[model samples]
Target chain A: MKKTKKVRQEELKKTIEDSPFITDEELAKRFGVSIQTIRLDRMEMSIPELRERIKSVATQEWNETVKALPIEEVIGEVVDLELDERAISILDIKPEHVFSRNNIARGHHLFAQANSLAVAVINDELALTARSSIQFSRQVKLGERVVAKAAVKGEDERGQTIVQVQSFVENEEVFSGTFHMYRSNQ
Target chain B: MKKTKKVRQEELKKTIEDSPFITDEELAKRFGVSIQTIRLDRMEMSIPELRERIKSVATQEWNETVKALPIEEVIGEVVDLELDERAISILDIKPEHVFSRNNIARGHHLFAQANSLAVAVINDELALTARSSIQFSRQVKLGERVVAKAAVKGEDERGQTIVQVQSFVENEEVFSGTFHMYRSNQ
Candidate 1:
């Protein structure tokens, strides 16, 4: 009887796959079962709860053309890294990595690329960025290669671990940034 | 004779406008002048000196794009502003401002937006971020509005002003951050 019910639920779900509004009541009625039963089946199938399902469909319809816009060039490459005194990877930046018009890389991109590399170095189940700050010196030009050397700065008063990163383009210090990533509950 | 030479210089500049690679020696020979004269013309036009100019052009062509792509809806709107003693701004998060399936705002956007607002509120002609640290309490969700409040925490040893910011969603504190931005010489 249990197997039979599972098969019925799967069939009903497929039938309503095209429906913008799939409700527990509708599925229950179609399968001649209580709404609770249909809800259990939905959960077992990993279907989002009603509110999330609604949001997903609405977001899809509202932003069909603009989902997951790809970023072409990731600014800095990881050449060295470290976490909590553990060396992980290192990053390098070349003159070809900077903006030509101003010779300064866009601040946010530099931060993001460096932060992403920092996150990548962490070997945790989940790591979330908490904060970051950066400083830029003189202009970095083409043909000059920069290195991003990082180290764990310190744990803050609130227990956030501060990571310091510096980028040197062809021996000239071009950029430096720091990031904080939160480690989830152990 | 002076008028003729001026017209010839204009023509040469126009030719190089399309192809900046036109060498000073080539321009001087073509215009019946010394290389020094062509170099002077280039300098007067505010073009980078030869070595720097080549580097600039090549860098622009190569680093054609190093953009900071915004991850969808990971930040909220500024709802309040206070620019005394410490620059501050309050922000609220909407449901769409979440990053992952768990409905938490990405940590980086939260800090970036708050830090940018604080720096802007400084009303200084030039300001650049220097360093920061932050911590997170809990995850934030969609449809739950958040409040981002900021203040200047203190100055670092290097004299950079550090600002503290916190974001609360649904009366529950979600994120808190500190930022440092440098005041430029007027």
Candidate 2:
């Protein structure tokens, strides 16, 4: 019985190595055990459930490009940031960054990227966006890597932080905006 | 010759209507003209080129619900609008109408929508945004359509118009924003 159990465990690990997406039923059948037993084994191994595994995969893909970077690298590369009382972020638009036939940068991406950069600069573990506003001054076009710059504008008595940011394509300024973020007390 | 041109015109219109994505080569071939000619026609109609057109379609789709209403209806929905000394615009957001995911409304959408509304309210033939500043206060979530109550904030002595606006998503106040719009003297 002990030899059989040991063999089953070895087979389970090998099965996992063969395909990461093994089902509980399949594992149970291979081990001559109940589905619940297979699940327990999975749990003991610190393997997430199906939904969690899928979510982790997606998160991994997303982090591959943007989220994996440290806050400092994100602030510097994605949004050229200038920190002070208020944070300022600048993003330069490139041809590949445009979403419109006119080659203009998409408004949402511009705002979100700038906001993300601003959030990174906050000296806190948890930062939340409270509000924002922006204006598109000129249409950005293809082949233009507009520089987006952000700066800290001010902070309120309640500790809410305000940041100003701008994006420029070519020599022309394309978009300018501002954001407010809140940090929870750790 | 006129009959031939009419046939070509019908074909071109059909291509544009049948598929929102009409390649320049296809259009040129149908019209028996150069790609440049098709481009010129598109420019004359204010239709952005391929990539821009694709982006416009997508963005329009996302904002379709809001844009479906007449401009007058938009004004009726929002309250407390004022023009500043420099013709800048301001608006207020009430908590009920903000997006659920980001408690605060998106900054670009706010600015672009406000700028468009400001243009509609203005006598100028063309209005361009130059700069802006925004601050967010609290989380304004789903079911809240921010009531943008605004006034003209300040005009730089350089003939720029700055508009200040406040927004409340439902009962919780969301954000306050200012926009700078430039109108051609024409």
Q: For all candidates, what are the clash counts? A: 16, 61
Residue A130 of candidate 1: its Cα lDDT?
Answer: 64
* Per-residue accuracy of model 2 over A1-186 as CA lDDT, tens digit each: 534655666777777656544457666776779999778777767776643442343212322222212454342244222233333333446654453234545444566566666666566555666666667777655544445555676786656777676665433566676666676752
For model 1, how does the per-residue alpha-carbon lDDT over A29-69 read when each residue is reduced to its tens digit?
76788999887887788886543543444322321111111
Encode model 2's per-residue lDDT on B70-113: one tens digit a residue. Answer: 34423223322222321222233444323333445444445444
**Which residue runs of candidate 2 sit more than 4 Å off their true CA positions?**
A1-112, A120-125, A129-139, A149-158, A161-166, A170-180, B1-112, B150-156
Q: B155 in model 2: Cα distance from truth in Å? A: 5.3
Listed in order, the DockQ scores are 0.14, 0.20
Please state the error at residue B11 of candidate 1 in Å.
80
Top candidate on DockQ is 2
Fnat values, candidates in order: 0.32, 0.49
